[model samples]
Target: MTGTTDTRPVHDGHHTVGELVNQAGEQLSQLVRQELALAKEELTEKGRRAGRGGGMLGGAGAFAYAGLLGLAGTGVAALSLVLPLWAAALIVTAVLFAIAAVLAVTGRSQLRRATPPTPEVTIGSVKADVEEIRERAHR
Candidate 1:
């Protein structure tokens, strides 16, 4: 025979069901770890967005308070340029409100993008792994 052979029994040299089961357990553990990581990342991103949005909302509240003071000619009149106090106050109020609107909108959109924190890809992969294991077990 041109081919060389290692004279070993097939079952002794090859993998067995016990080994496969152990490997499957290891793989399952790894998959769970990966899924947990994904969930953590997702929640972290969402939490950051929520924090930024809340901060922007707080900023909007502050600006609105300042606007009220501007109208009352108490806080913003000194900061006015060549324009009259009321006109400058109105202009500052409008600009502050516009910036708040933009921040609020941008923050809201970021928050919306991270609604559910489930690891969808990992879930699907686990389901498929279960199905494959079931099929192989049947054989």
Candidate 2:
């Protein structure tokens, strides 16, 4: 047969069965190496995106802290009209603390979600391919 594939070099139909098996082994080895590379690339891209998002979250937290400080100052100024200065400042401090607590909990949840960046989809695809190959070999 004319078996001159880009990957396999089986010329003139003179290759023995053992030689063909050896070629198959070589192709399988190459396929495995390429698949591993794809998995690594996919996982790396996912991790990079998650890391960027986490940095944005940190930036948000910082800006929120600054804004909260400004708002607390404004609240104390407004409330000081009806109460003593210390009581108004205390009220504003309590409210600001509550907001900070909420944001800290939410940030923790997001950070937990961004961890353990594995290529799950690629792993499943590779498993399916391996099973298909096994089935065909059985036939």
Best by lDDT: 2
Per-prediction TM-score: 0.47, 0.72
lDDT comparing candidate 2 with the true structure: 0.88
Write model 1 residue lDDT over 24-53, tens digit each, in one string: 899879877876787677668877998999
Which run of 10 residues does model 2 get worst, by summed lDDT? Answer: 1-10
Residue 88, model 2: lDDT of 100
Give the per-residue lDDT digits (tens) of candidate 2, residues 107-136.
Answer: 899998885767887888789879988997
Clashing pairs in 1: none
Global local distance difference test of model 1: 0.77
**Cα deviation in Å at residue 81, candidate 2?**
1.4
